[model samples]
Target: MDYLIKTGCRKIVHFAAAQHLLIGKNRQNGYLHALYKNGIPVDDNLIFKCDNYNEAAHLTEKLIRSGNTPDAIFAVNDMTALGALSTIKSIGLKVPEDISIIGFTNGLISTMSDPPLSTIEQHGYEMGQIAVRLLLNRLSKDDDGYTPEIRVLKTDLVLRGTTKTLKEDKLGRGLLY
Candidate 1:
């Protein structure tokens, strides 16, 4: 969300997950925080509980038909983002030109898209390894003295062809400040 804001995107459409899931709530909260920090007002109509490919495609097509094309789109996952990308192109819009897109979960599909997708890499492999190690440690414990541990992993922003960055300098030149 911050990436989109920093890139000068004010009207961002978010493809969110269900509110009941903790991960979804966390992501939505982060999205709201980023918008607020960047001084961008939240447009209630721009958000949708869309986390899958079919729903994303349908909603995107509807938005396009309504002539409410967003400046950028932030989807819950790569598949959902891909669906939007396909719809946007089908409607004759160009990625990173008419609109920008970013997705969570940098899966293989992200790189396979036409222009490729910009996404957040959650380091799933590392997460799985950490989980296995944690489980083994707990299992090998002789007593209940071994306390559970929580490991935090950092996510990386992998930029690709489907998005653009517009960094404004102090002098308003194209150079990033």
Candidate 2:
């Protein structure tokens, strides 16, 4: 959001699976919270309730045809981001140069894009390793009064070719200013 505001993206399209899922709900809340904190009013049109790649592509194309193309787009996952990329290009627009596109889950496909993709790395492999280790430990302990514990993994933002950063001097230019 700081990046979006800094880059002067007035309209941002958000793609989510469903508000019922905790991850989806959290992502929506975070996006909206960022806009609110930046003093930008939430626009319902910018929010897409589908997370599928085909739906994202179709919806993005529709927005472009309707002359309501967004300055930026954030997809729930890399596959969906790739879908948006294809539609954006079909409409004769350049990534980052025209509209910045970002995605969650820094999967293998992310680095395969023409300009690559900027995404959030959730460290799924590491997470799986940890899960397996926990399970083995529990089995070795014979489930002897072991209490379940919640572990939170940190997420990192990996910047790549799909996004842009503006040069700022001193106070800089953005909605917050």
Candidate 3:
């Protein structure tokens, strides 16, 4: 995204996981939004739709072999990132050295990787808490005219071994340290 460009990455590949799904579509939109907001031109070629780890890995390999290797990769999820990392390694490349990688959803497996993955943490616990509260509120309200309220939970970026810090000037407020 903007950070990747500011960090001197001219080419960034996005591995989308099932764009038909709500989460997938939203993530893709966010990625495009970041690029547009940063004044980066959209490149359809760099966007690859992948459903799982295997598809991601296969695409990564193909991209490399075709001399279309990206300077950075943004995966839809930790599993996709892991698969891309495996392909990158198989091609004799180093993580955060030759290319940087980032994933969404800071799942447990992310921390256990060889070079721990840098990921965005979705506050699942807080979300569940909010959901329960909403349910209680709904149950407590006997009025049939009650309207649903929408709430947006924030996410945090957990920096780890997969990425390096960009220059201070390139840093944005969106990243939660």
Candidates in order: C-alpha RMSD to true structure: 2.7, 3.1, 3.8
Expressed as tens digits, the lDDT of each residue in 32-150 for candidate 1 is 88999888899899999999989999999999899898999999889999999999999899998888999999999899998999999999999999999998988889776698686
Compose the digit string of candidate 2's lDDT tens values, residues 53-122: 8998999999989999899998888888889999999889999888899899999889999889989899
TM-score of each: 0.87, 0.85, 0.84
Over 4 Å off in model 1, which ranges? Answer: 140-150, 167-177
Question: Mind giving the per-residue lDDT tens digits that candidate 3 earns over 4-113?
Answer: 66666768889886877878888899889988887778899999897568988999999999999888898999999999988999899988878888888898999998
* C-alpha lDDT of candidate 1 relative to the true structure: 0.89
Question: Lowest summed lDDT over 10 consecutive residues: which window, candidate 1?
Answer: 168-177
Query: Lowest summed-lDDT stretch of 10 residues in model 3?
Result: 168-177
Per-candidate Cα lDDT values, in order, are 0.89, 0.85, 0.83
Taking all chains together, the TM-score of candidate 3 against the true structure is 0.84
Judged by lDDT relative to the true structure, which candidate is superior, 1 or 2?
Answer: 1
Q: Select the stronger candidate by lDDT from 2 and 3.
A: 2
Scored by TM-score, the top model is 1
